[model samples]
Target: MAQVLFLGGLGRSGTTLVERLLGELPGICALGEVVHLWQRDLRDDERCGCGSRFSGCTFWQRVGERAFGGWANVDVDRVHTLRDGVERTRHIPRLASAAQPAAQVREYASYYSRVYAAAAEVSGAKLVVDSSKHSALAHVLRAAGDIDLRVVHVVRDARGVAYSWTKRVARPETDGADEMTRYSPGRSALLWNAHNAAFGLLARRGVPVRRIRYEEFLADPRAAIIRLADFAGLAPRPEDLEFLRPGYADLRVGHSAAGNPMRFTVGRLPLRHDDAWMRALPPAQRRLVGAMCGPMLRAYGYPLNPQEAR
Candidate 1:
């Protein structure tokens, strides 16, 4: 069975940073946001940060070879032009089930085990990182009874997440621009709340899970990295931190450049843009997010405004 590390969290919550860092670990290959199962159209014009066009990404091309047995000669331009709608609903489920069997959950585990093995072979990494960050996918992976799965539940402040969403919303048009614009602060908060809640529920049910705050991870990354290594049963190494640094340069779909300052290859790192949310977010938007996600803020150990709490 292959060792699988899942960096599960809501979008824009620093999953990419964590994924890159983990991928840096010797023998670890991290693939960014291969949420192909949820994709309605196989094509999207956006590059997946692997430096390859999504439909033509070499990493995914290899994954496709193992998954489907032969290249199949997928059309990248058509895939990019494809619209993800009704057709996706049918294909997504089939692809997901193909990766895991309903009758034999262990078969699903074996499927992922193979996937990880394939990834390791391609990237020459001992471990594989999946940054899908989807609760549903995580649930399915957990159901597979083969590999030892570790869930890294990464969280960020709701306000910060919302602010980040606002920035993305203001970006120039590209493939799936419509889908991207829909991720407002309200939506972002709901996603954060739901994802964290789902992860919490799974943890309570005895899934091998660990939670890490984006704030804490930024504040003392070495300590946080050590803790994560310990939880994953990985021996600490000097190269681990070095591997994690390059990921900060990855600016792709579902990945953010905002958190780059929090990243360091070694030694003590100072906080960067931790309070940027306060200054970046307008007073109205901040108030709205605070009011909307007050309960969640409290649950995540954030203080709600006194006036709003009442």
Candidate 2:
């Protein structure tokens, strides 16, 4: 069975840093956003975290050979069609029911199962980290029945997440021709609520869920890494985490398939909080996010008023 440590949350919630750090521990492999493996890495041929294009990355080449006889044998278009039909927020109720399979959720899930298994086999990792950051994908895997799934739900303050979504960030994995998608605070807030709620539902359904707040991690990254290592079922030895020191971590270039452009980062990576939203965000937009996020704001321990945010 495929053993997956899935990271689920809204975009810009600090998943890359956690995934990258976790890979430094023994017997764990970080796979970035495997949800985009077929389209972004296979079809478009984006850059992997190892500084090689997807086709040139020997690690992925081995995985493709192992998973589907070198990726060409797999039908990318067919998988995309199946993804649209089964792996979306609108398809959750259909996926949640163990009694139903007519929506083709199992068919789509089989593809991911193969990919995850191949990754573990190729890297010899005991657990593979998939920081897809989508609650819909998390729910799909929970209902998959064959894979062993554990979730780490990372949450950032709605105001900070709203602010991050508004800025234009470069996608180096692309040919420098496209920027990451930007979302308005109102829209980000709506997603903030929906994404967190879906992950909460996963925990209730007994999916072995753990929540990590971005603010908490920024405050004490070393402690958080130890906690996360334990959660992923790697009761890490002190030497396994030697790369980590207070306020900084020595990172390695990864062979991740897809994720935030930060996946391309290497060397001494500093861990710090980005509260740019506090100083630069217009008060009006912050309040709008606070209002739209509703009780999910408090559920994750953020104040209803942005000014009162920690």
Candidate 3:
């Protein structure tokens, strides 16, 4: 059976870096945000982590051929639509419910299992890191009986997450198309709660889950990697972390489908906390983020106020 490290949490919570770190480990293959593989990578023609177009990459081509015979028969638009409609936050309750109809759910999950099985076979690695960052999708993938899935729920301070989303970071994958995302602090806070809460429910429902705080991991990545490795049933040598540098690891290119432009980071990974929000974010937004996410923040051991967060 193929094992999967399914990354479930809000984006910008350090999942990409974590995924890259895990991918660099021996016997682990990081298939970047496989959720975005169909639409962003295949249909939108985004760049893979190795800097090749999706269809142009030999590794992905092989995976496709092995998983689904060929890419021509896979309808990107249709698959993307089906995935989004069935696995967004709004659809979580139904998908997780035992009483709900699941004909389509089974179909989508079957697609994921085949892809994951093919990835494991092609990479010759026992572990696959999928940083899709959606709890609902994580639920679907875990429901697939054939794949042994472990969830890594990454969390950051809600205010930091909200601040990160407010910035206009360019999507390097899209070239000159001006791809970027911005969300209001209120929206980010609410979604953060919803996503994390859903992941918690999944854990309570008996899925193997290990929650990693971004700040904690940044403080001691080696220990963090070891703990995560143990959770995922892998053994790491001292040299498995040899890629670690002062700030960032010397990460290699992966066949990631979609994620932050950091997916393309080749050399040094600066292990710096993004606290610029403390100085840059307005008071109202900070308060809004805290207020919207206060209960969950307290539950997750974060200070109620951003000013109090270290």
Candidate 4:
């Protein structure tokens, strides 16, 4: 069985950075957004974090060989079908319960178990980090019965999330030719609510979940990361975290599966809490996001009013 530190949250909520930070730890291998692995890497042949095409990346090629004797042995379409049938947002309820779906769901979960275990085996890391950011996928993976899955639920203020969605950020993994997807303020808020709510239900189901607000994590990166490392079952010495020096972190290029373009960044990167949304987001739109997020905004420790948040 593989122990996976699963980062579950909505996009742009800072899971990618956390994944990167965890990857730098001595015995952890970060595999970004494994939820998108089938389509993004195997089907599309996108670039891996190592800056090589998926087919050309030696790391994933070995992972494929180790996991299923080879990627060729797996039925991509059947795996997709099984995943689609049992990993939808609607299936979270049943997937998290004792009466979790059998049959295809179990079969689907077996694939993830193999994938994670192979990642650990190939990298020779004590644990693997996956920033999949989907609660439904977390539930599906938990059904495997052979994985030690730990969840880190990242939350950001909905207003910031709405502002981020409105931005036209480029998708560098797609050769900077395509931009990332965008969503309306209402839709972003609703997703923020729905995603965070699922994690709440996930925690009650006895999963080892550590909820970290994006704002708080940035405010104290050093302490925050150490706490997160501990929760994920790693006991790091002070020297193990020398990557965090003052306000910047020393990063390295990784062979991630799929994620934000930031995953490719290396060397030193500045860290800060992105509060631009407070001023840049239109007042009306900010209020709309707040209203849409409703109680979840407060439930996650976000102040309802814009002023109080600051």
User: Best by TM-score, which number?
Assistant: 4
Q: Which residue pairs come into collision in candidate 3?
A: 247-271, 248-269
Question: Residue-wise lDDT of candidate 1 within 1-310, one digit each (tens)?
Answer: 5677888777778876676555545556665554442132143334444333445566756765765463354443333333132112233344343544454334433445566666666666656677767765666566556567888999887888888777644322233354344467777777777677777766755668888888778766656777887787777777555533421322223221111222222332223435677777777877878888888778777766533321
Q: Which lDDT tens digits does candidate 2 get at residues 124-149?
A: 99999999998888877765666889
lDDT (Cα atoms) of all candidates against the true structure:
0.59, 0.86, 0.85, 0.89
Question: Whole-model lDDT, candidate 4?
Answer: 0.89
**Residue 137 in candidate 2, Cα distance off native in Å:** 1.1
User: Which is superior by TM-score, 1 or 3?
Assistant: 3
TM for candidate 4 is: 0.98
Model 3 Cα lDDT, one tens digit per residue, 32-96: 88887877766777789999998899888898899899877787766766787688888887777
Give me the overall lDDT of model 2: 0.86
Which regions of candidate 3 fall more than 4 Å away from where they truly are?
99-101
Ranking by lDDT: 4, 2, 3, 1
Candidate 4 stretches greater than 4 Å from native: 98-100
Candidate 4 lDDT by residue in tens digits, 1-310: 7998899988989999889988998999999999889998989989999889889999999999999999888889998999889888888888877575688888988888898999999999989998999989888776778899899999988899999999999987787889999999989988888889999899998889999999999888889888998897788899988998878899988988999988888899798879999999999999899888878887788888888878
TM-score of each: 0.71, 0.96, 0.96, 0.98
- Regions of candidate 1 where Cα sits further than 4 Å from its true position: 37-42, 45-48, 54-58, 71-114, 169-179, 239-271, 305-310
Between candidates 1 and 2, the one scoring higher on TM-score is: 2
Candidate 3 residue 169 C-alpha distance from true site, Å: 0.9
Ranking by TM-score: 4, 2, 3, 1
- By summed lDDT, which 10 consecutive residues of candidate 3 come out lowest? 95-104
Q: What TM-score would candidate 2 get against the native?
A: 0.96
Report how far off residue 50 is in candidate 3 (Å): 0.2
